[model samples]
Target: MAAVKLPTQRLYGTSFTCQISERNKDPPVGDEVWGTLVKEFSDVPDASAITRITVRLVIAAVLGGVLGFERESKGRSAGLRTHMLVAVGAALFVLGPLQSGMQIGDLSRVLQGVVQGIGFLGAGAIIIRSAQREVEGLTTAASIWATAAIGVMAGLGMEVTAVLSTAIVLVILAAVPHILPTPSETDSKSIGDD
Candidate 1:
């Protein structure tokens, strides 16, 4: 008797399971495809001090969420939830080192690496569609970077600073746009218009 072939599993992120069947690879019979499927998975971290990590994640989420809320209110592409998740994830990543209480050299290097690493994400947020006709996401990109910073701060147990920074971020997000001048008009005219 022949053994049955098992479906392949694809892991997503770090805990979700995604099963891919052989049939899914079959070529489309017609120009119009019916049900295209893709598997997604993430690995959930298993640890004793899950609660502590969870707390850090939540704090980072809240900090990012605060900024995300501002963006959402303005109808930006990356909104509250996206920001929250990014911040929280970054915070948790930082917590691993912090909780272990590792060497000073390792910790310092990790800190620098974290800042440098977030740049990739920030870069993704910023895109110039055209040379003269540039469309920028400066605010959103900056918010993402700030969110990461807040996560690091939270991971370091700077809870008060995290919370205060979140609040200040919200306030600045709200007030800055209103006070800034429009690009179409001259500086004096723009201020006057405001």
Candidate 2:
């Protein structure tokens, strides 16, 4: 007999099963097409998913925008769009596995990945001037890190928590500065920029 072909194989020491099938790659027709495109967004059908996806994403964006407004008012490089994108991106990272039915325990990996990825982005905001012995963007970097955490909270459906946290962050970014003592004339030049 001719050699039989198996639908499964072991690759990279992991055995996997594979199925060959054809799917309709073409777009759907009529009313079905509309639902097919937006079922996940419809109020009646996918209400829960809508809450998870749309509500969370919007909350993330608004909160991020608030943070961005503060940074932008101060003429920081990482402003509104940057912060909003970071918040929304962080929320999506959590939302994807959540919509896929992954257990809460499995989400730790996703959270870790988001934090590490945001760290790289925050690092970009930092500026170290060795000759001038000045460190800049610390506050901006910290804000990005905190914004990601807030996004994660929003994505987890903690809307109230997200709002409260946003309020607290706004206070830290805005009120705390005015309340703090000003830098001395000698310290002004070397003071870290936001």
Candidate 3:
């Protein structure tokens, strides 16, 4: 009995099993078709993957910048570059698992780590003005947290969600102060009455 040989090809550094009959000198039309399809679909060039990653990073950075710009306009210490870096870093954290082909469950762990890490950074932004009995930078810290979330959405390929979230954030940051008076303003109003 003649032993049948199977053709194999490498994809992403892994070989795919190809079954073909030995009776024919050439591979069957189906095998040839399959081989061509595999080469076309499975052999993604590294440059293409890099481009996708770069795009995601850029989207994350832009979304973060939008929020950062609003905070910077208010003269907050943690402004454009800080928010951009936070968003880019968070997106990369999510992207790492995706590029490695990690399962969703594993990806959740990475996301959890990203959130926890951002919490520490947000904490750094918060300051208690004990003499004035006031807390400052809370809004800036919250914006930082939200920027990270936008990055996560962008990295997960939810560009619409990221954009919408950023829009809502900008609206809140820009409009809320005008809608409600600040503590100092209220205090001054009361002092003027006295």
Candidate 4:
């Protein structure tokens, strides 16, 4: 009896024969694009995939900037650049793990690391004045944490969620302060009555 031959699949314009002997063979040389920084493990990304990645990164930065702008306008310590960096860093962290062939279960661990790392950065922004019984930079720290989350969403390809979250964060930063009294304001009011 004769064995039937199986069809081969083409990758990067090279035919990958499905023979058991060929399974361990390396991919053909000259198959990679010369200038791309990212190397695809399973398959090369076409122009569309590259464009999508670029778009996601840009969106992440812009959304982060929007939140950063709000913080900057309020004269916060962790302003535009800090927030933007956090977002971009978070996006890259997720993107790198994904591009490196990490499974979905493994990806969750990467995200957890991002959250925990961002928490440390956020903690650094906080200041407590014992004598004045005042806390500063809490809002800024919270914003930084939020910006990281926006970046994570962008990295996960959730563009709409990232954008909408940015808008909502901006609204909270801009409007909520006016609706609520600051610690100083409350203290002053109480002192004046006394």
Q: How well is each residue in 35-75 modelled by candidate 2, as lDDT tens digits?
A: 77687555334567665678899999999999999999999
> Candidate 4's residue-wise lDDT over 86-126, tens digit each?
99899989888887789979899899999999999999988
For every model in order, what is the number of clashing pairs? 8, 0, 0, 0
Q: Estimate every model's Cα lDDT from 0 to 1.
A: 0.71, 0.86, 0.85, 0.82
The digit string of per-residue lDDT tens for model 1 on 1-194 reads: 33445555556745444554666655766522433221111123456466666677788887888899988888776788878877876776677776666765688778778778778777776656554455567677777778888888887778889998888877777887777665655433221111
Q: Name the candidate, 3 or 4, with the larger lDDT value.
A: 3
Off by over 4 Å in 1: 1-51, 131-135, 187-194
Question: How far does residue 104 in candidate 2 sit from its true spot (Å)?
Answer: 0.4
Residue range with the least summed lDDT across 10 consecutive positions in model 3: 185-194
For residue 175, model 4's alpha carbon misses the true position, in angstroms, by: 0.5
| Highest-lDDT candidate | 2
Error of 4 at 71 (Å): 0.6
Better model by TM-score, 1 or 2? 2
* Candidate 2 ranges with C-alpha deviation above 4 Å: 1-45, 185-193
Summarize candidate 3's per-residue lDDT along 82-175 as a digit string, tens digits.
Answer: 9999999999898878876888787888888889999999988887766656677888888999999999999988899999999999998888
- TM of each candidate vs. truth: 0.64, 0.75, 0.72, 0.73
Best by TM-score: 2
